[model samples]
Target chain A: MNSFFQYFADIFNGVKSLLTGMKVTGRYFFSPWEIVTQQYPENRKTLKMYDRFKGEVIMPHTANNEHRCTGCGICETNCPNGSIEIIQDKIDMPDGKKKRIIDKHIYHLSMCTFCGLCIKTCPSDALAWGQEFEHAVFDRTKLTKILNKPGSSILKDISE
Target chain B: MKEVINLPVKNIEEEEYHINMGPQHPSTHGVLRLVVSLQGEIVKSLKPHCGYIHRGIEKMCEKDTYPQIIHLTDRMDYLSAHINNHAVCLLVEKALEVEVPERVKYIRTIVDELNRIASHQLWWCSFGMDMGGLTCFFYGLRDREKILDIFEESFGSRLLHSYYTPGGLMMDIHPDFQKNVKVFIKYFRKKIKDYDDLLSGNVIMQLRTKGVGVISKEDAISFGMTGPTGRGSGFSCDVRKHHPYGVYEKVQFNEIVRTEGDTLARYLNRMDEMRESMNIIEQLIDNIPAGDYTAKMKAVIKLPAGEYFQRVESARGELGVYVVSDGNKTPFRMKFRTPSFSNLSTLDYVSRGCKIADLVAIGASMDYVIPDIDR
Candidate 1:
């Protein structure tokens, strides 16, 4: 007789427990304000990434088109993957000495792992993480970018 | 026989059959393939075949510098990425004999506990889903997002942040880190009670998990199971408790253990652990000291010629990092004694007599992240 009562008690307890679980779901169901999902494309206009988001690498040039990179190639060496290549050209200085200048600072976005090693190890703080995350392109060649603006020269005070 | 008639006899009930559970199955989580032999519905034996997602991380470590190896460790156990990175950082610090600042120690411990809670949250949701409760998935991820936001706001990347360097943190945490974490702790505390209601006390969850996939304490130790899986079997194997590192010694938190050694016990252990993690975070968040985030070190780090081993209690289990350095920038050989590899070894032993459906629950309870196993 006790076994029969215990069986019924078990069923009753199980149903009650399940209902307790459902109560949570039901509460959230009725409350639309509790929703946490952000409609991605719809809210793109107002979306802002965090200040420290490691989106991609970029070389910041001053308004005068002078960059801090001296073509030392420390970033190229520090990068785990061969993503950065600094093309150098020798220029005859006014003092009759040949000085090496950066012709093009090529950055391969496809090969970059976004590890931030290049930026961390940069002595001159030449490289910075850009907020532009949309790197998708139809052609693979588009990912290979020249970081320095056209005909940009090195910052005068930064050069030793 | 009396009519001298020949008849084909088949003993289907006694016959054992085999079925492949994974390599693509949802329940397997990642690329883990389990060849399970069954006699009808009951699983006779299970053989977990790993290496499907192996990226040759160990071999890759041989060539990469110590700093470069930090990112690779993130891929091993992506769920416990912080803890994995912590293990390597601890190992390197021990070798280099650099005393990290008190601030760094406090922050590392707080972040490690936070990572543990996030990992448990993910496990809880997936475990529920494995048991056919889809709602748990959404609830778990929803709460987990709060923790990921904390990681992203400070560490930059959400999933695989190699935030910990050898000497200390990659950079000092964001100004709002402490405030944000405190808010999350307060918010999650109220919601955790809901977790108990939704899954822990549910009759179906109890019925499906209790007395299932049981492993004795002795068997658990023998199988080299650590973390919550071993704790479920009443094994006091928390690396944080036994061999405390960083600021873990200063903090106070109980190592949750259960003697039941069953799926329910493991589930409960992780649930209790999440609460403990919040307690840990609460203890350190307010008392974070003012000091340099990183210790002064040379640009190039070279460990003296020797073999070194360091173990840390990750979200899953004790993650052991063994390194042999020939006094170079790169390690001569690196071997990771990952928790999931040893934990997965015991699957066939524990789930022998369980129903095939119960296998999913057992695997979920074990919480063996596949990349950790393969790596």
Candidate 2:
């Protein structure tokens, strides 16, 4: 007789619990403004990323079209994926002593993992994170960037 | 002529057939294939196939420096990104015998709790979807985004943040980080009730989960399961309680346990765990001491020739990182004893004699990440 009563009580309790669950979802259905999803691409103009957001690596050029990279190759060694390559050429200095100058700082965007090791390890603070992230290209070769701009030179006061 | 047909007497026997579930199916979560042998609807035996996403992270660690390895751990157990990074940081700190600042300790603990909640939230969303309740996915993901926003403002990435370093954090917390976390805590506490109403209280959910896929306490220990999956069996294996690290010892919170050891019990354990995580974060977030975010260290970190191991309680389980240094910048040998691998090994043991449908609930309850197992 006790077990018979317990079975009915269990059914009653289960029904009550299920009803309570329906109440929460029913309330959400009426409140359209509470929906959290944003139309992603449509809101692209108004979308804002955080200030410290890391997008990609960039080397800032001065007004004279010169950068701070000294062809030290620290970033090249620090990169875990071998995404950076330093091409160096010898130039006759004003004092007639041959010195190594950076010919090109090749950055392979396709291979980059954005680990930030290369930028962090730059002793001269030559490299930094850029905010631009829209980096799609038709050709794979277009992604390999020469960070040293054409007709641009390294800073005159190059130090080892 | 009645030629005696060379056929033996016909016999009836129940023959078992096999079915494969995912290397692509949505319910398995990530590329984990299960070969389930069955007699009609009942499962006779089960086998799991892993290693689809193995990227040789441990091998790569041998070539990269200590700081670089922190990035790789972000991929393994990606949901518990902060905790995984913390494990590597702790290993490096111990090898160097460096004492991190009190501020760093407090901040790390608070962030770790927030990380735990986010991971549990994602698991809850997918677990609901696995049970054929699609609405729970939207609700769980909506709340989880708030925590990701806090991480993004401070840590600079949503899914993967290699923020923690050996001596300290990569950068200081954002100025608004405290205010945002406090607001989120207040909001989430109220919604946790709705979570119960929307799914936990539902009769269908209860019927589907309650008293399903039970793992015994002795079996849990033998399988070497840790974290909530083991705790559900009343194993008392909460790593945070047993082995306190960071500022965990200073905090007060219950290590939730359930003796039923069933699917429902494991589900309830994670739900209660999210609340405990909130309690832990509240205790530490307000009292973060003022000190250096990073310590003074050499440009290159070279450890002495020795093998060192450090373990931390991740959202999934206890993650142990072992490093063998040969007095070099990079480790000579690196190994990770991830929790999901052991938890996954017990699946075949528990699923035998149950219906093939029940295996889905059982697998969902274990909450094993595929990459973590393969790694």
Candidate 3:
């Protein structure tokens, strides 16, 4: 008779515990304000990314297309996967000095890990994180970006 | 053959049956294949075959610089990314003998606890889903998103934020980092209580988990299971309390341990850990010292020719990173003792004699990330 009473007590406890659990979920179901899901694509216009976000690397150009890169290749050396290829011209300047200038700073976005190592190691501050993060592409070759614009030359050293 | 000429075998089948449960299955979490042998509804034996998602992380670590290795560690245990990053950073700091600023130490400890809670939130959400509780998936993700937002506002990435670096952090905390964290702590405290009411008290959850996947403390230690899985078996293996690093020595929090050695005990230990993590965060978030985020170091980092190992108490368990430096910018050999690998090894031992449905509860209680096991 005592064992039968214990069995009923166990049943009551289990049912009570289950009902208590249902109460929490039921409360959330009624309170729609607790929902936190963002509808993607529909809310794309309102989406905001933080400033410190590590996006694709880009080289900013002045009005005259003057860039800060000097073909020093510190970023290329710093990259773990060798994603950056710094092509040089080695121009003989008007002052009878052969100086290395960046011809094309090829950045393989496909191979990039977006670790910000290349941007941080650039001595001339040539590279920075671009705000644009939509990187889907059809052609694999499109990922290789040339930092220097067409007909763009390195800014002549005014300090010298 | 003479005895069973007319009728087939009553219990044992003539053919050895085998079924694969992963490498792509939803319940496995990642690409983990479990070769399960079933005798009717009961799981006779289960063998976990890993290495489907292995990207050769340890091999890649050999060619990368000290700072570059942080990016790779994020891929190993993506949920506990911050804790994984912290392990490598701590090892590099110890090998180099670099003194990180007090501010960095305090911020790192707070961020690690935050990451711990977030990892547990994801585990709790998915564990419920694995046990057929669909409502829990939403509730767990809902609370976890708040923590992910805190990560995004500060580290700029939600899942794999390579935030922590050797000697300090990758960058200083955001202007509103402290305020945002404090607000999250207060809000989560109220919501965390609902977890107990929602699932802990649920009869179905109790029936599914209680007294399932029982492992003794000796067995837990022998299997090298750490984290809540070990703690559930009454094995005191919390690395934070044993080997205090960063600002853990300064904070006050209890290491939760359960003696039941059952599935529910492991699940409850993680729930209790979230409370302790919050307590640790609250204690240190107010006292963030104003100083340099990173210490001044040489342009190129080269460790002395020696072996250095550092273990961190991640959300899962003790994540030990071993680096053998040959006085070069890159490490000579790198090995990671991930918690998931050891924790998953105990699956076969505990899952035997349990039903097929109980296997899910046992695996969920272990909380082994497949990629971490593969790595």
Best by TM-score: 1
Clashing pairs in 2: none
lDDT for residue A82 in candidate 1, whole number 0-100: 87
For model 1, residues B1-375, the per-residue Cα lDDT tens digits are 367777888776689999999899989899999999989899999888888999999999998888888989999999999999999999999998899999999999999999999999999999999999999999999999999999989988899988988898888999999999999999999999999999999999999999999999999999999999999999999999999998988989999999999999999999999999999999999999999999887888898999999999999998999999999999999999999999999999999999999999999999989999998
Q: What is the TM-score of chain A alone in each candidate?
A: 0.95, 0.85, 0.87
Q: TM-score chain B for all models.
A: 0.97, 0.96, 0.96
For model 2, residues A1-160, the per-residue Cα lDDT tens digits are: 9999999998998888877877888888899888888898899899888976777788999999988999889999888888999999899988999998889999999998777778777888888877777889899999999988988787777663
TM-score between predicted and true chain B, model 2: 0.96
Question: How would you encode candidate 3's per-residue C-alpha lDDT over B1-375 as one tens digit per residue?
Answer: 557457554655534467898878777887889999987767889988887888999999999999899889998999999999999999988888999999999988999999999999999998889988888888888888888888887887788888887888777899988899889999999998888888887888898898999999999999999998899999999999999999898888999999999999999999999999999999998899999999877788999999889999988998999988899999999999999999998999999989888987888888988779988
Local lDDT at A158 for model 3: 27
Candidate 2 regions off by >4 Å? A1-11, A155-160, B1-13
Q: Write the per-residue lDDT of candidate 1 for residues A1-160, one digit (tens) a residue.
A: 9999999999999999999999999999999999999999899899899999888888899999999998889888878778999999899999999998889999999998777778888888998988888788999999999999998989988887
lDDT of all predictions: 0.93, 0.89, 0.88
**DockQ per candidate, 2 decimals:** 0.81, 0.67, 0.70
For all candidates in order, state the fraction of native interface contacts they contain.
Answer: 0.78, 0.67, 0.71
